[model samples]
Target: MSQHPAVTFRSAAVVLALALGAATPAAADAAPRSRPGDAVRSALDELAGGGEFAGALAAVREPGGRGRDYTAGVGDLATRAKVPVNGQVRIASTTKTFTAAVVLQLAGEGKVELDAPVERYLPRLVRGNGHDGRLITVRQLLQHTSGLPDHSKAIPGTFFDNRHRYFEPRELVDLALTQQPLFPPGKGWSYSNTGYVLLGLLVQKVTGRPIGAEITDRIITPLGLGDTYWPNPGEQRIRGAHPRAYKSRTGEPGGEPVDVSEMDPSRGWAAGQLVSTPRDVNRFLGALLGGRLLKPAMLEQMKRTVPVPGAPRGWGYGLGLTKISLSCGGLAWGHSGDVGGYSTRGGVTEGGRSATVTATEKSLTAEGDKRLDRFLDTALCAGQRPAAGQALR
Candidate 1:
């Protein structure tokens, strides 16, 4: 397993202190609730203190198949808007989970074979890289092992100051093609927004429809996920009432903490463009894991990949879904999303109980990611006691 850059125990201690220190008052808030509710509430409070996120909203499905919603903090900072139990926000990479679902649906219909070579559709993408772009498969792209670079640079720096601008999907793909291959197709794992954008294009080609249309026809409408949509820059503004996402410009060279409530969908494009509420995320994930979406055989195939030890969820792929082991005695199948000023983590237990929390903070820094994972862990593992670390794998 590739370890994250080592942090000295002292630094870790400082972070832990910050996390636990924030938890104290939250724990107090939960004192009036039942143990399970208290656990969930405590976790939400700790997550809210991280400067990047404005709020955390969650829904945990019960064994009897009922779901409960929990929310904390203000959704929008300037207006002090409370995050509605049904408030929608940018899903970022959580859109991958939906993307994967559509692909799996196509696979089931025999429209696209997961193992087929990509040369059939995108012949020019890998032409000169000493890599057989033909060797790249849909499955590899979904699994993040396609050896493609994360064409984030495809997004112009100027757009960072004005994230509400739109760019065509072709423009994003062009940026990816300009970069060198990170590795040969199927050789290793690297998170590549580029691969998914291509996958989205393939979905368009194979289905003879836009990716958004197919997702709506196949997944969203059927699931009754009324709050989810594939939005664009024109539709960038946060609707109804929700948290205003903030980005840390703390150490950025002459940058101010930017409010990111109106970020561009083109920045994420197909890789992270979906917008949804916490309740909808929970519903979609829970339905997927509960065998409501994919067939038993296909679901098994999706869960068949290798596990990345010690990561929150051991890595595996089927379509866009990922497998993760919770600190509690459960395995969750879902995806995490990060884009501009939004961060989302959501999953459904193997048995179909689900939990999800979305925050408005997005940062590449170690501290930021750790904080996100901690909040997700708390939401997913709420009632259960922590298990031996072995289960984390």
Candidate 2:
């Protein structure tokens, strides 16, 4: 029941779908393919055709190659506009990976300590009902083991009702502080956007600059991610040509859908507010897993994972990245994100093969989520189709 829309989509159903079995064929014509990107495209086509999303876009970069892009459905359902192949979309919690990267970079520079208590940087700021900064380490925050309740879940409202509201990072943290911690720090695993808000505040306190600036200077700029950006306060429109976003009426089966493409994103903040294109997202994951974002030691530390109690089997939570053991054989590292009108999932393999897929709809039905996973698995496990009844790791 995390407030973030993405967390709702990450419920047990999606986890189980990702953990077991091969891609279930979307239709009778959906069959295995031999070409490089054909299987991946088929997966996208299946998702788009199933009527869960207005459109879908996917970008894939093979090892030592220029990459390919695929699109399915319409960008604008009203006008039947084709989905932009490299359009900008709100990359929700995936922003956590970028935030974690900046913090880890600070750790490498001796400016921050991963194991130090959060109080070491933001004293008194974390104190509240059953919550304490002294016992929570920076690593705990990055890894979602801080036990902080997500502020989004604490508040109640629809995207349209709160679109114009601006939330200070401290304000959001306070909302969570008003509630008891889910568990003692590091004693359990639970995703907490509030923990990342604290991390964002920590970055500002240490650097005397907004966390967005730190990410832009340290990661985005360095990687030449021209299409990625942190939207400023009150900015509700996505820059450049992009697909419109939609959300289910009540997030239930057959709920009415509405356009949520343009809404204030300040509420998401450091927790899940980044806007990026599929190409940029794929490049970022590629650079991150390819050892361009952090030092070897820090990157290894980031990869050290803990079991996610409710997540799918063979999946674990690392600092910010999610590690999934594919049924087709191989490990894929990346994250998934959800905001009001967008849903995105992407990953990078050890071989440098990377892919990112995005849909215009924010909340997906369980079956839709399964189709999305099938798309990701097909893309990442290209050419290595899993055999029938092969055990999924």
lDDT of 2: 0.76
Could you estimate the TM-score for every candidate?
0.84, 0.90
The lDDT of each candidate is 0.63, 0.76
Query: lDDT score, residue 76, model 2?
Result: 91
TM match of model 1 to true structure:
0.84
Task: Rate residue 84 of model 2 by lDDT.
Answer: 73
Per-candidate clash tally: 6, 2
lDDT per residue, candidate 2, 1-393, as tens digits? 112211223532111122111221212122223245566766777777877888887777776746777777889977888887578889887888899899998898999999999999998888979888999999999888888888886665766778768888888888888888889999987778888898899999999999999999998999899989999878889998789999887886567778888887777788888999877887888888888889999999999999876555667778887887776776788887777877787888788877788877745765666566667777777677674553332
Count residue pairs with overlapping backbones in model 2. Answer: 2
In angstroms, give how far residue 151 of model 1 lies from its true place: 1.4
Q: Name the candidate that leads on lDDT.
A: 2
Alpha-carbon RMSD to native, per candidate: 6.0, 5.1
List the candidate 1 regions with Cα displacement exceeding 4 Å: 1-37, 50-52, 129-132, 250-255, 307-318, 362-364, 389-393
